[model samples]
Target: MMRTRPLKVALLGCGVVGSEVARIMTTHADDLAARIGAPVELAGVAVRRPDKVREGIDPSLVTTDATALVKRGDLDIVVEVIGGIEPARTLITTAFEHGASVVSANKALLAQDGAALHAAAEEHGKDLYYEAAVAGAIPLIRPLRESLAGDKVNRVLGIVNGTTNFILDKMDSTGAGYQEALDEATALGYAEADPTADVEGFDAAAKAAILAGIAFHTRVRLDDVHREGMTEVTAADFASAKEMGCTIKLLAICERAGDGASVTARVYPAMIPLSHPLASVRGAYNAVFVESDASGQLMFYGPGAGGAPTASAVLGDLVAVARNRINGTTGPGESAYAALPVSPMGEVVTRYHISLDVADKPGVLAQVATVFAEHGVSIDTVRQQGKDGEASLVVVTHRASDAALGGTVEALRKLDTVRGVASIMRVEGE
Candidate 1:
């Protein structure tokens, strides 16, 4: 007879991800038991409203008082899907203090206060696993935290937000403007009513913070990430992308500085060459590309977010934490050992594509090229076309610091020959 520990789990929130947690718990019971060498059971469910009907769940398991549920006796694990910084953080801390391991899908809470939560878990010697907090259902946090435990990771570049990727992919394939693609995504339920977090790059920035901290074993907080949303990305940007043999994607990029003394993490819309693997990751899917000393380039791709997919990731973490419990061992904790400083955006090195609307004069092109030269940013290519009293100058520059590029743009904007600086975009995945 196999020795069974009879794990009791309390799940909070029955939203998209929580319902899937219940469904999988019911169907995978025997398999879960076999894998854990024990019977895992749902002890309780914490929800805001108790009157709402929920299926595949024992009515006795549901409760309106979430705080009271965590305080109840004998909970082996608490899975939090409520998602916020306040009660969720307080509830998770309480659960850990009460001798329960925690599995969470709360990215904001984790990104904002992961350090505090991890400290609480450490003080109580409990597990705090949040595999679903990043890319939904993609095996990223685990692989970065564990599988690459020995490898030296230099970079983690990803399309970590699904809604933005879906919108961008739609725009890429259909040549639709930002609003047009956003409308289609909204109609399809891929985007929320507000869509601020997804489109504005806030969501991806949080994920980047979490990923940078883990990959570099440093405390890279959410505020440390430089965020520039994709709302400003126009249809013309996509058209220019096509002209340059590229696609525009909202990328969450984190990389170790060349000196290896610091790291840089940012979320912004970027133009990437079509040959890159990440360019092929279309629709609402997510992909993460990692560069390491030992592992040169590695990519993990799958459905980024959905209730069921994210729940699947939580369950996978459940199995790992459960087995670790049976063995009386704790997994890795926050490893900011690299303790690298988070660098500013001005220090980042990348290529740029600058579109200039200038007065149609004989020397306008040379004046624009002169501005770039003064800043030490060499131009790779320049294409100019004259229109009615105005000319459009498209200049692609070789790699240079963001500071240098910004200086060049500032000087160009001041030029008498330049009517206006239309746009400046970063070129990535080259």
Candidate 2:
């Protein structure tokens, strides 16, 4: 039996994602009502520009006062697409206090202060679902939170940011330098005007923090994840990657230690073998690879971002929260029972590829080899090419602590024969 009375929903922010949420709500009202067992109404839409025409939204429902809209006391659900910290945080807590569930797409807010927001929702006995927060419409959050609840996830590796992936993909295919690739990405609208958030790995790091928390059932913050931007990736780096049957990608990696006592999260540009599934991911697409105890390897791949794609995720959460409202129940809340300490970058063990400019002399190689030996870092392979009075030595090292690798590099830099450190890249996906 379906309820005839409508469930009121308040929408905050009517920009790209918010507008689409409204459009879908109206256009699919009949279907949503049937699925949710009650009619859903867009009671009000909060926006900065109330006078601007929103195509499918009613003018009467528009308001500049978002705070008042969420506090209307009749709303069953509040869809927050306003991506930030301040008012979004306050408004969400307020919405729960006023008897409404929240479906948000604010990754930054969640990454920074998810525990507090989750506490607020739990305090008010309301559902807090944010499926659109990570990897756009790929359905990562809910799966990690619900579908894989019974399973033990050990590692999560992904290309989370489309902008950086687009730029790196261009550099790999066209052999263009970082600047040239970034300019192309900007022109194609794949990158923002400032592009710092995407290019500098901040965007991916935020997503990594969120994914790490849920996957490991731990509390991982944005600052906990180590971040390295892709701005310094050069065409020569890609050339070396080709020589080793690999390609470069900006990856977000989250892992639980072997004993399952600690976890680590990081974002950096790495060289993955062409045979790896992630290496084939091109353009602005996103893919996440998960390894668990029961489920050996699972991959989720799709369009990571776009108004429509992200809006699709938001709407899916809307339907879920709406159904839960009708049933008088809540979905899964935060699960930080593990509470694993996030390990620092120095403790992370991984392979490295280092390139060095040295004097084309006989004993220069011995000196470079000695540095690695002193640091207890084993060498996998070494390739040295002579050009006039100078030579380039490319060294691929075996698995070693990041601290050891850093020490080895520092020692090499002080050697008189070492002219310059051309590049140092982490190698992964073996």
Candidate 3:
């Protein structure tokens, strides 16, 4: 019953991920054909540098004009591995218009304009699957979109960025400072030269936006996600965390508010209990915890990046979309039925680990405790260390709104006894 006519697939961006995708398609042609009920052919490969030699790809099949390749109405699928906004966005839209479904690995573009892209696919009656967008090889999107379609997911918390994890893990294991750990990450090729996107939480923030939108069934844009980078994470922070039976990690957290009427998405460096699954997720690996009403808790962990891993996800989507094509159907589109409002960061309720530099004297602690009390932030515990008339007062506050914590810090900074607000981090996964 297999179709003799092969399905033509156009590959855009012959880079790290695109090349691997092509290699896989060619090597696994027979299997894909049998599984998909149709032989899959790599019709064209679009690349900026056509002269660059790509092994296993035909020289005649390469083209510099990506737009034109996708415009060919004969294409059944357009796999976009170009990790950017402009060209990828336009090409993806164009592909749908010309009768081709899309499989993309562009996180930034999807996180930015996923609704628009989904609409484009739906308008043309095509599938737009981006399983490779969020967490490289890990199958996160489809689960949130399809598998958990019946269940209500309340909380999603985990270490989503591998680069930051590597840096933080190195610091925790080797007692290295932020700079030292970042340098090691860069040397090991775990971090980029600039590393702004990964370290600054922008990368994780985009993924958070995607997760929140899907998990909450609302439109969560990139701007909606509150992002705080890991650059400010210091060795002393790790020591403080260790003392509290915790470790620091850059986490992407999405949650439904108390009433389940609103949602919150944020990416930042926080202290998670050492016993938590995410804390043990060392090296450049990704792990996510999905808490639901029925499923209780589910953890998805794997290598979140690299060519081969990402390509695997891309191929999974490709096979799915191919099956849909053969069946003359499409997968689930955007599910913003709830349309819950995304609450601001100030409204987010979580514990705070605040370190303050204060004068070593009586009544200083009382004044600080009064500030917390006045702001409605109850102190769970307080530890003070004095040295040469200067003191480090570490306070862990019970669950409180971010606005109250901000107000407390502002009030503490104004007190003459308080030298500085040394550091403030959120305590999560407790």
Candidate 4:
């Protein structure tokens, strides 16, 4: 019953991920054909460099003109691995117009303009799959989109970026300062030369936006996500975390409000108890913890990024889109029916750990306690260390609105007894 005629596939971008996609498509052609019920062909590969040799790819099929390749009217599928916005967006729109499905791994593009791209695909009656967009090969998108379609997901917490996680993990295990840990990560190739995007939490914020949208069936954009970098995490922070039996990690958190009318998405460095599943997600690994009405708690963990791991995700999407092409059908499209408003960070309620440098005096503690009382913030625990007329007060507060916590910290800073605010960290995974 398998069709003998081949289904033409056009590949855009032949860099790390794109190259691996091509390699897998060629090496597993027969298996793919059998599974998809039709032979799949790499009709053309679009790249910037034409003279460079592609080991498993035919030289005649290589072209520098990506637009021309996607414009081909005969292509059944277009695999876009070119990250970023510009040409990727244009080429994807063109591919849809020219009657081809798209399987992309562009997280930034999807987080920024997913609705528009989804509209284009729906207008052309094409499938747009991006399993490789979020957590490398962890299979997060499809599960949130399809497998959990019948279930109501309430919260998704994860360590989405490997670079920040590696840096933070080093800080936790070795008691290194932020710069020292980041330097080690850079030398180990876990971090890029610039490392701005990863270290600044922009990368995790983009992923949080995407995950929030799919998990909540809502429209969450990149700008909607509240992001906080890990640059300020210090060795003293790790020492405090150890005292509390916790570890630090850069986490992407997406949750639906109690009323079920609104949602929130944020990325920040937090201290999670060592007993939590996510706290054990060390090194460059990624893990997402999902809580739903029926499923209770489910965790997805694995390598979050790498050439081969990300390429594996891309290829999975390729096979899926290819099968749909053979069946003359499309997979699930965008599901923004909820249309929930994304809440701002001020409205988010969570616990906080605050450290303060204060004058070592009896009445200073009472002054600090009054500030929390004035702001209606309940203190869970307080630890004080004294040395030569100066003392460090570490206060861990219970669940309170971020606005309230910010107010308390501001008031504490203005107090005559308080010398400085050492660090303020959000405590999670209780």
Each candidate structure's TM-score, on Cα atoms with residue i matched to residue i, is 0.98, 0.99, 0.99, 0.98
Backbone clash total, candidate 3: 0
Q: Count the backbone clashes (under 3 Å) in each candidate.
A: 3, 0, 0, 0
Q: List model 3 lDDT by residue over 232-317, tens digit each.
A: 99999999999999999999999999999899999999999989999999999999999999999999999999899999999999
lDDT tens digits, residues 1-430, model 4?
Answer: 9999999999999998899989998899999898888989999999889999889999999999999999889999999998899999999999999999999999999999999999999999999999999989998999899999999999999999999999988888887889998899999988999999999999999999999999999999999999999899999999999999999999999999889889999999999999999999989999999999998999999999988899999888888998888888999999999999999999999999999999998899899999999999999999999999999999999999999999999999999999999999999888
RMSD of every prediction? 1.1, 0.9, 0.8, 0.9
Off by over 4 Å in 1: none
Model 4 regions lying over 4 Å from their true place: none
Query: What is the per-residue lDDT of model 2 for residues 228-308, given as tens digits with 9 covering 90 to 100?
Result: 998899999999999999999999999987677899999999999999999999999999999999988999999999888
Residue pairs whose backbone atoms clash in candidate 4: none
Q: Candidate 1, residues 39-115: lDDT per residue as tens digits?
A: 89999999988888888999999998999999986998999999878799999999998889999999998889989
- TM-score computed on alpha carbons, candidate 1: 0.98
lDDT of 4 at 206: 94
| lDDT scores of the candidates, listed in order | 0.92, 0.93, 0.95, 0.94
